[model samples]
Target: MENAERKELELFAAKMRRWIVEGVYCAKSGHPGGSLSCTDIICYLYNKEMKVDPQNPKDPDRDRFVLSKGHCAPALYSALGLKGFFDINEMKNLRKIDSFLQGHPCIEHTPGIDMSTGSLGQGISAATGMALAAKLDGKDYRVFSVLGDGEMQEGQVWEALMSAAHNKLDNICAFVDHNGLQIDGNVDDVMSLGDIKAKVTAFGWNAVEIDGHDFDQIEGALKAFNENRGSGKPFFVIANTHKGRGVSFMTDNASWHGSAPKEEQYNIAVGELDAKIKELEG
Candidate 1:
């Protein structure tokens, strides 16, 4: 990516982090650590890569994305809101009573959501089905999905990967947010996902590893996926990321995995993110 473009993405990601923290802090009941961790990848996909139109979100020919790790709906909703899918003010009402933006994504409520997701492993299955549908219908649209590192432990995720590869679903490109922390604690302490890339490659996927926070690497991996299509293999990206990426106290802290920041902490996080955004934008 060019310097200017990289800066723009960085700014967008910063704003996403700000919004993620703000929404979770207001709700006092949603996951912020993983949401903040995956904000960059989501921002890049919506802002630069995916051929989606907020004007016509249901456009069949447009690319599809699934937040398989759906607890991170704050990030996805923030991305969608910034992309013009809905009013950005909706973010403040996250997890509120009868709000469209719930704790998890609901396709019926959200304009840009391709599938309702929150069941950990089910979203990947839905994404695989969408990819297979595109192939069966001979459509050119691609499907993308992001999974939490902790979510990789679900047996259904591997089943979906196996089906994607066996069906030769090259239209599917998946990412694993390898932040290494889950709700209870460290993913290794919970259940070690030994050699994720090797396991996926053995299942017949073409895998690429990259730093999830780096715009250059994120853009490069996405471009490489597009350039290397038609190889008859599903693509997997292992994005190594920090659990709480932008804010100081949250970074790699398991306690922040699903806890909302208190008033003082929220101020600090927003202040940090605003400064970063200003620096990047300037």
Candidate 2:
């Protein structure tokens, strides 16, 4: 990617981080750590990778994205809003009784959401089914899904992976946000997802691991996936990221996983992201 393009993406991701903090703080209940960690990848996908149109959201041939780790709806919602799916200000109303932006994605209500996903491991299955349907219908759209590292413990994710490979869903690309910390604590302490890359490769998919926050790695991984198309297997990218990535106090902190920040913390997060945005913009 060009330097200018990379800077633009960095700025966009920083804005998304601010939106995540704003939404969660306003809701007083929602996940922010993982949401912030995965913002860059989602921003890159929506802004530069996916062939999605806010104007023609239901276009069948458009690429699909499912946030398997759905509590991170704040990130997804921010991306969708910035992509012109809805008024970006609606993000501040997150989780409100009258707001369309719920705690988790609601496909029926949200314009950009391809699937309603909140259950830990179910979104990947839905993404796999979408890819299979595309193949069956001789369509060219690709399906993408993002999963939390902690979510790796769910057996259903493995089942979905098995099905994706067995069905030869090469059009599907899945990302495991290996951010180490979950709501409880370290993922290893909770349940070890030993050798995630090896496990995915053994499941008969192409696997690559990268630094989740690095735009170059993120872009390279996607390009590599495109280069490897027609290989008759699904693709998986294990992205090593820090929980609560952009905020100083929240980084790698398990307690921030599902908690709303207090006023002081929220201000600090916004301040940090603002400075980062300015740095990138310069």
Candidate 3:
């Protein structure tokens, strides 16, 4: 990426982190760790990868994205708001009693959500189905999704993977947010998803591992996904990320997985992110 583009992405990701902290703090409950971990990918997708229009969010030919790791709705929702799907101030109402932006994605309510997902391994299944449907309909639109590393333990996820590869759904690209931590202390401790890349490759996906925080690597892997469109195989990107990124106390800490920050911690997080944004601007 060019210096200007990289700087723009950095600033956007910082602002999104602030939004994540703000929403969770105001709601007094959420999964901030994974949300922060995946914010960059969401930033890149909404900014550079996906073909989405805030004015016509449901255009049939537009690319589709599913947050397979749907608990991180704060990140996805913020990306949508930043891209003008709705008012960015709407984030303050996240998870509120009457807010359309609930804790998880709901396609019925949210404009940019292509799939309503929160039930663990089901999002990938839906994405795979969407890919197959697109092929059947002779459409060129692609399907993109993100999965939690801990969610790799699900048998249903493997089933979806196998089915996608078996049917050669090359139009689909997905990533594993391998943050090494889940709500439980560590993902490997709770359940070891040994050699995630190898496992998915064995399942017949064209897979690659990369630093999830790095925009260049993310774009490279996504380019590889695009190249595989006619190769009769699906693409899986194993993105190594920190569970709680962009905040001091929360970074890599599993406790922040399903808990909101207190007022002091929230202030600290917002302060740090604001500083980063300022530096990027400078």
Candidate 4:
């Protein structure tokens, strides 16, 4: 990507981070760490990669995306808002009883959500199914999903992988946000996803590992996915990322996994993101 294009995506990702923090802090409850870690990828997809429209959200031929690690709805919500799916200020009411922007994505209510995904390991299945349906319908759309590294512990994720491969769902791609930490602690200490790329490749899908925060790697990975359209196999991307990325104090901190930042911490995090956004704008 050119320097200007890369800077634009980076600036949007930073703004998404700011919203994630602000929304979570406003809710006084929500996941921020995983959300921040994956915001760059999410924003990139919505802003550049996916074939989505804010005006025609129900277009059947549009690309589909599912957040398999759905607790990170803050990131997804921010991306959707910035992409013009809804009023961005609605994010402040995140997780509220009456808010359409709930703690997790609700397809029944949200304009841009392709599927309702909160239970771990399930969203991938939905994405895979969408891909199969597209094929069956003789359509040419693609499906994408993002999963948490910790979510790989769920047996269903493997089942979904197996099913996708068995069906030769080449139109579908999935990502594992390989941030080391989860709500409990390190993913290795909780449950190791040993050689995630190898394991995914063993499941008969093409797998590539990249730094999730790097726009170049993200762009390259998506390009590969596009190139694999008729290869009769699914694609998997393992994105190494730091938990609570872009927030200095929260970076790599598991304590911030599902917890909202305190007022002071929120201010600091917002300040940092605001500074970065200002710099990028310049």
Candidate 5:
């Protein structure tokens, strides 16, 4: 990417971080660490990678995204809002009664959501199914799914991984948010996902590891996957990321995993994000 485009992505990521923090703080009960960690990846996909239409959201040939780490709904919701999926003001209503934005994603209730997912390990299965359906229908649409490293403890994820590889779903790309932390604590301490790349590669998928927050590496990986599609394999991008990426106090702090920021903390996060946004604008 050019310097200008890179700056644009950086600005988008910064704005997304602010939105995630604001949305979670407003709700007073939502995931922040995972949301912050995954913001850049989400911005990359929604802003540049995915072939989507906010205007024609239900277009059959449009690409699909599944947030397998469904607790990170705040990140997805913020992205959707910025992408014009809904009014930006709706973000403040997150996790409230009768709001389209639920604590976990619900496709029926949400506009841009392709799948209703909250269960730890069920989303990958839905994404695999979508990819299979596209193949059966001979459509060129691709499917992307993001999973939390901790959520890999669920056996159902392995089942979906095996299925995607066995069926040779080349149009499907999955990401592992290897942030090293979960709700309770670190993933390695809670339940080690030993050699995630090796495990997926053994299941017959093309796997690449990259710094999840690096735009250049992420763009390169996605481009490479697109170039190699239909080579009789699935694609996995292992995104090594900080648990709470942008905020100084929250980074890698397990306590922030699901905690809403207090008022003072919210002001700090918003201030930091606003300064970055202003710098980009300048």
Candidate 6:
């Protein structure tokens, strides 16, 4: 990415962080840590990477995105709102009665959601099916899915991985948010995911590791995936990220995994995000 484009992405990330924080704070019931941790990846994909149109969301040839880690819907919703898929004001209605934005992604309720997912290991399978359908139809579009490190523990994830590799679904790219923290506690304590890169590679997929928060590295990895498409293998990106990135009190804290910020803390987080946004905009 060029210097100007890089700056634009940074600004987007800053605004997304603010949106995630504010949206969760307003709802007073949602996942904030994982949402914030995954903001950069979501922003990069929605703003720069994914070939999507908010106006014509159902365009046949548009790129597809599946949020395998559906609990982090706040991040995705915030990105979609900023991308004009929905009004930014609707963010306040998150998790409320009759709100389209639920705690988990629901395609029937939300626009631009390729798959409705909350069950841990199902979204990837749906994405795999989409990729296979595209291949059968000889479509040029690509499919992207984001999975959480904890969610990888599910058996269905490996099943989907095996199927994708066996089918040579090179048009698919899956991103693992290896933040090392789950809702319970440290992932190692709950369940050790030893050598994620090697594990995916062993499944016959091309795996690359990158700092999830670094826009340049993320962009480069994505470019490599696109260039290497049709190499007879799927692409997997292990994004090493902090659980609660960009927040002083939230970073590396598992308690914040599902906890909403209190009124005072919310003000502080909003202030920090606002300052960063202003700096990036300048």
lDDT of 2 by residue, 1-282 (tens): 898989899899998999999999999999999999999899999988999999999999999999999999999999999889999999899999979999999999989999999999999999999999999999999999999998989999999999999999999999999999887999999899998888999999999999999999999999988987899999999999999999999998999989999999989999998999888877
lDDT for each residue of candidate 5 in 1-282, tens digit (9 for 90 to 100): 899999999998898888889889989999999999998899999999899988988899999999999999989998899889998789899999999999999989888999988898999999999999999999999999999999999999999999998898999999999999998998989989999989999999999999999999999889978977969799999999999999989999999999998999999988888999999999
Per-residue C-alpha lDDT of model 3 across residues 155-260, encoded as one tens digit per residue: 9999999999999999999999999987778888999999888899999999999999999999999999888889999999999999889999999889999999
Q: Which stretches of candidate 6 lie over 4 Å from their true place?
A: none
What is the C-alpha local distance difference test score of each model? 0.93, 0.93, 0.93, 0.93, 0.93, 0.92
Give model 4 RMSD, 1 decimal.
0.6
lDDT of 1 by residue, 138-234 (tens): 9999999999999999999999999999999988999999999999998999999999889999999999999999988988899888876898899
Clashes of 1: 0
Q: Cα deviation in Å at residue 270, candidate 5?
A: 1.0
- Model 5 regions more than 4 Å off: none
lDDT of 5 at 224: 78
Model 6: per-residue lDDT, tens digit, 170-253? 999999998999989999999999999889999999989999999999998999999879698999999999988888899999
**What lDDT, from 0 to 1, does candidate 1 have?**
0.93
Off by over 4 Å in 2: none
Error of 6 at 130 (Å): 0.7
lDDT per residue for candidate 4 within 1-282, as digits (tens), equals 999999999999999999999899999999999999999889889989899999999999999999999999999999999989999999999999999999999999998999999999899989999999999999999998999998999999999999999999999989999999877999999988888888999999998989999999999999999998899999999999999999999899999999998888888998999999999999
Model 4 steric clash pairs: none
